[model samples]
Target chain A: EDKVVQSPLSLVVHEGDTVTLNCSYEVTNFRSLLWYKQEKKAPTFLFMLTSSGIEKKSGRLSSILDKKELFSILNITATQTGDSAVYLCARTPNNAGNMLTFGGGTRLMVKP
Target chain B: DAGVTQSPTHLIKTRGQQVTLRCSPISGHKSVSWYQQVLGQGPQFIFQYYEKEERGRGNFPDRFSARQFPNYSSELNVNALLLGDSALYLCASSPGTSNNEQFFGPGTRLTVL
Candidate 1:
């Protein structure tokens, strides 16, 4: 069975703190990894990582995939309360017809 | 362009009843997928349809079925619903079946009584 595990299921931090969320996966025919920020309804796309070592960044958020280690990490720098949401990591396997297997997700609460 | 849209934001049904959820993919998107999400858990894949054809399906039981229309809209039907069938049904759409990013709908919250 394909599995995606996320660490630190929940986190609480004050504004301006940096946080790192982890995601590890065991899947067959791995294709790509995706990150999403879910707040209230529907998950909004954040990043998609397909290669190792190369980091994808959007403003204060960044993510990198380590295929050798079968894991990925999402880093948020200078966080704000607006960053409070559940961060989800999902993996797409080849021949799966674009279906994604998602992790339990890390719930982030950034305080003001 | 409009994003993925789902109908009946909320629904309530009794056990043994049948329910249907609807979804409309974004304009120009040909692929639509269904997922079920329980509280505090990640969404689980249910079905994927593209170009009016069934492309992929998840581990869900035969009681859960779906079909795509010619216009790329889709409907998910669940028969003989059980108490455990209560969950948030999500619809996602992508441009193709490859590695494209999927856009998700707001989801329908189904409550079984």
Candidate 2:
């Protein structure tokens, strides 16, 4: 079975703080890793990492994947209260369809 | 462009009852996937439909089924619901079945009593 494990299930940080969320996976075939932020009902897309070492960034948020190490990390620099949400990491396998296996996710609470 | 959309934002059902959830993918999208998310847990893949064909299915039991229409809309049906079936059901859509980023719907919150 393909499994994804995320570290620090929950974290609390203040404004302007930097936080790193980790995700490690064990899969037979790896296609890509994706990150999402869930605030209320829906989860918004964040980043998709396919290659190792190269980091994908968007403003204060960035992520990197290490295929050799079978792990990925998402970093938020200078966090704000609005950034508080559940961060999800999912792994897609190399198959006919894009079936995602997701980690339990890290709940982030950014204080004002 | 409009994102993926799901119907019936909330629902309540008793055990042994049946429920059907509907979803409409984004315009021009040909692939749709269904997921179940319990509180405090990541969403679990339920099924994936591409071009109206069943491409992938998760470890869910036979009581759960889904189908994609020609218009790319889909419906998920669950029978003999148990209390454990209560969760948020999410629908996602992509351009194709390949490596594409899926956009999720608001999700349907189902509470089984």
Task: List candidate 2 stretches off by more than 4 Å.
Answer: none
**Segments in model 1 whose C-alpha atoms lie over 4 Å from true places:** none
Q: List model 2 lDDT by residue over A13-66, tens digit each.
A: 999999999999998999999999999988899999999999999999999999
Q: Per-residue lDDT of A22-78 in model 1, one digit per residue for the tens?
A: 999997679999999999879999999999989999999999999999999999999
- Candidate 1 per-residue lDDT, tens place, B89-109, comes to 999999989999999999999
lDDT score, candidate 2: 0.96
lDDT of 1: 0.95
Query: Could you give me the TM-score of model 1 versus the true structure?
Result: 0.98
Provide TM-scores for the models.
Answer: 0.98, 0.99
**DockQ of the candidate models in sequence:** 0.83, 0.91
lDDT of model 2, residue B93:
95
